[model samples]
Target chain A: MTALSAAAERLRIRSGAYAGQTAGLARGHVQANLAILPADWAGDFLRFCQANPKPCPLLAVSEVGDPALPTLGTGIDIRTDVPRYRVYRDGVLTEEPTDIRDLWQGDFVSFLIGCSFSFEEALLADGVPVRHIAMNRNVPMYETNIDCVPAGRFAGKMVVSMRPMAPRDAIRAIQITSRFPSVHGAPVHFGDPAAIGIRDITKPEHGEAVPVEPGEVPVFWACGVTPQVAIRTARPPIAITHSPGTMLITDLLNTHLSVL
Target chain B: MTALSAAAERLRIRSGAYAGQTAGLARGHVQANLAILPADWAGDFLRFCQANPKPCPLLAVSEVGDPALPTLGTGIDIRTDVPRYRVYRDGVLTEEPTDIRDLWQGDFVSFLIGCSFSFEEALLADGVPVRHIAMNRNVPMYETNIDCVPAGRFAGKMVVSMRPMAPRDAIRAIQITSRFPSVHGAPVHFGDPAAIGIRDITKPEHGEAVPVEPGEVPVFWACGVTPQVAIRTARPPIAITHSPGTMLITDLLNTHLSVL
Candidate 1:
């Protein structure tokens, strides 16, 4: 089937016509990790994102009480644009809802954080092998010993996604991703996983593990999950986040996000 | 002593006031690898450089019989501007001369290729620790199994210079070096030495081997020695090159080499 444009995909999600994961749907478009918080908690969250840009690259932040993220896309209703959202109460997952309009509050602030999809597209375009994609598994993620600089109530260790590749391919991947800082930029670390405090190569804190073959090193990039972890640590009264793998499809072209 | 400007360094070399290595002599200038070949052999050598740019990045090619490289600097004499010269006959080094005026040939074509000093300076400035520099040893050079694309008789296995860096520094180095494509560009390989056909990282074919500490991988860049190896294999009737570690200092600033 022909790929849907980003606008069409978002429209489909908003209309409740499509509620599946947004992965591989609108090719060449930016997909964002979504976070909605009460206005009181958003100030700290914004600072957290700013302090740890590698993990929480902020693409757009909505004004308080606004459901529309005009910077991300025209006619984008944050309350319903995401295919699925995980509603949280005091850091606990309360429900999974297709739309957040019922849970939306007058003092809610929405954040659209950059996802790995953009840089992964770039790496693939440059012929750099992304092992997880080849193995048809989610990119492996681990919580590093590295701490994210705390801001207000948001305090936690940085979480990073892992992709195993030969050093040559890793070098090329570094160059490609450096152009797109909005999507995690270059890798935080590569080679020995133990150096970054990852204990076992065969196991991950999140996602399925892919084989790191002979002559290959496990490369790590700051993961989008970092902000979610921070939110849980913050323990705000109410928060909403897009369900895993089901990101908000935005009208921003991935290429347009390349700082270069 | 205060560092000499590029022009002053070349002038000192020309006047026989300096006959030592050019490294660390002029802080920010672009130093070059020199190759002088009789006109008859120049065409094929130029083609070889064109085909294998990563190893033999051509900076300035002098017109036939011209003693001065006007493009590189004002009144710069190729025969005298370099601190030392290695005269070769039938693929063997016949003499190491402080000056090559006595051996100058009108039919000689001079080629200036990019040297790693430009990128090395960049790496150092970016807080990337160059292991060899830190250890006061030569960067390790290895003969790789990777073959250069042959142009006429100018062909041989590619030679690479290795620098051991932690994966984080290596990533930054890759980004910095990639901006200077003329100076060997990004590294050819990193991690396992055996993958690149180096049997032992401790034993390099040329240059002193520095320590590769645990948690660090050996990052290899296309070495300037590759062209010298190719020149030796080609066996021109007469050829001249700058002696090892003694390069021709040019007026060009290293920062000017950044394509970005």
Candidate 2:
């Protein structure tokens, strides 16, 4: 997109001109993890999100069958704004589509969950190095043994993203991320991986492993993947999510998501 | 003290009715670490404190030879308000006295440094259990290989205090303490003691070591002892400090120290 505006980026996505991962696009805007569920299943999922805010910080919930996310951006079409969408049937992935307009139901409700990019931006701006970003790799994520507080059918373990840094940087990261509660807030854990039930530090359930250097400790933050895992387990008749790393770019600035 | 007010507690110390550690004594108030040095040496010490704020967070610097700290409290007579004092001559501890009025010099400049007690109070209030406090032991203190930025004659390695906490609690503690920049602020390091050059976790140079259990990591904060160590190395002709836990109680509430 010639313009860096979030709406312009969305227009590019909507017009089928761009269908790539949205990282570093529309700089300063908030990018969200998407989960579209049937209106009948939406209430329980809303409660599930409310109960586990760190992993599923709800930014907006669209009106049933209405694709526009009024609060998050102007003229945003949830059905097509995201670069790519993953359609799942009975908790199994069915298709990775550029747009879900044909699959969209009149009774569907879209949930926009906060992504880690916001806090990662905050950390980088504060001069704290995020290992995965520096290494040009996906942040190593683990499906932890820590259980998500159950809400109706949504019940599963929490997933966390790991970043390796020196203890001093980790401390500063903790302070910096804490200001953005919507963007997964502060880290859930740090140091030993086994303490949180991740058996192997070298092998994560999702994302590539970045080297935790000699003096660096692995710092873990609640990942946006958590809600998707929960949604998968819940086994609703139909579920649609943004393909990993392809988030919905919103008009809201990442700084606007900061609680402070 | 009859009342929980810091002023009342100071009055008791001033009257020689209480000559004990000020921990939990003036419940919601701020208690400070004390350091009094000659005028010629005060400027450098002030610069040292400024350069290394995490360890030596200077709260108030007194006018030369003045025992009264008007900005810290109502009718605060520094020479007698603290429960106990340690007299050091040429970097050697000479005596432990309840009062330092007789030893007060015309050029003596008192420096009030923020104590950990203020942040510990914040931690306990937030339901984060401080290990040493729970075990009824002193928080373990260690001298680190990390050097403090020197100013004039003031130069020494950094000293730190350890508190064992689970990663979750440690994260919360970091967020909580970061609000009180005047009180040693956030932890300098956490996880491994060896990383910061503590040869033995059990054998602390100062204070008693509490057990760091499995599933727990030792979090290190910049200790108030750092300045004391620096002063000792500086070898001012005559130097005085509060004896360990015996601090100068002040009227400022612990909540008042919160930066947010």
- Candidate 2: tens digits of C-alpha lDDT, residues B151-208: 9999999999999999999999999999999999999999889988999999999999
- Candidate 1 differs from the real structure by a C-alpha RMSD in angstroms, to one decimal, of 1.9
Candidate 1 local lDDT, A1-260, one digit each (tens): 22257778888898999888777888888999999999999999999999999999999999899898888888889999899998888888889999888888999999899999899988888888888888878888898898999999999999999998887888899999899889899999998788888899788988889998888888899999898888888889999999878998888889999988
Which segments of model 2 are wrong by more than 4 Å? Answer: A1-4, B1-4
Locate the minimum summed-lDDT window of 10 residues in model 2 chain B. Answer: B1-10
Query: Worst ten-residue run, lDDT, model 1 chain A?
Result: A1-10
lDDT of 2 at B195: 89
Give TM-scores of chain A for all candidates.
0.96, 0.97
The CA lDDT at B100 in model 2 is 90
Question: Which prediction has the highest lDDT against the true structure?
Answer: 2
